[model samples]
Target: MNKEETFIKDLVVLTPDVFEDARGYFFEGYNKNKFSALGIAIDFVQDNQSFSQRGTLRGLHYQNPPYAQTKLVRVLQGEIMDVAVDLRKDSPTYGQHFGIKLTAENKKQLLVPQGFAHGFSVLSETAVVLYKCDQFYNKASEGGIRFDDPTLNIDWGMELKKAIVSEKDLVLPDFANCNSEF
Candidate 1:
């Protein structure tokens, strides 16, 4: 795996080496030893998956401290514009965000550390995202910022008016008003 650092501290993009043949291809999506060698030693306890259609947007979400999660996210099928925002109050990149295109073709994965908010927008006809989390979900600890928060000024690569967002996510607080405990 090749690790590349994003502008935000501790956030990384990992590209795995793929071996392809006429019939198929192979890659080690995750190997404990390889990941540990790359300095990512989190013991993920849960795996989550989601399927969405094009223009479907989700997040700018994070879990509160004590239940905060570190996620390793990738696309299993189709494509998406994945985003992560640093919520660490003292971090240099606090409030800043990073966006990248993740697709089955590229096999790129985003490593979002605990002190960050994450979200993604499906860009293909259909998309299946799979992610591993270091911590389990806690409804009481769930938190989120609006996907189109003015303060963040993220370009979702599509028109907001056409984006299909959940009612809960649609009402999330803007960046400045969010209670980012991280």
Candidate 2:
């Protein structure tokens, strides 16, 4: 596996070594020892998965303290434009965001540490995204910023008019208005 740092501190992109044969391909998605050797030592307690159609946008979401999570996210099927925004109060890259394309073909994963908000836009006909979280979910701690926040200027790689978002996400506060405690 290879780990590449993003512009935002603590946010990394991981490329796993894949083995392919005439029948198919395989790769170790996660191995505690290997990950620890790479400087990631979180004890992920939950796994989550979601499926969305093209143009669907989900997030800019994060959990507040006591429930803040570090996520290792990847596309299990199809493709998406994944994004993460640094919300760490004292980090140099705070308020900055990074976006990358993750696809089943490329098999790349994004490691989003705590103190960052994350979201993704489906780019294929249908996409299946899977992620492991270091902490459990807490409804009271849930928070989000609008995907189209002007200050963040995130490009979801799709026309705004074509994007489909949940009502909750549609009403999320913009970056400047968010009360991020991270």
The root-mean-square deviation over C-alpha atoms between each candidate and the true structure, in angstroms, is 0.6, 0.7
Error of 1 at 64 (Å): 0.7
Which digits, one per residue and each the tens of the lDDT, describe model 1 over residues 3-117? Answer: 9998777999999999999989999988889999999898999999999999999998999989999999999999999999999999988889999999999999999999999
6: Cα error in model 1, Å: 1.1
Model 2 clash tally, residue pairs: 0
**lDDT at 121 for candidate 1?**
96
Model 2 residue 169 lDDT score:
97
Off by over 4 Å in 1: none
Against the correct fold, how does model 1 do in TM-score? 0.98
In candidate 2, what are the lDDT values of residues 30-147, reduced to their tens digit? 9999999999898999999999999999998999998999999999999999999999989998898899999999999999999999999999999999999999999999999999
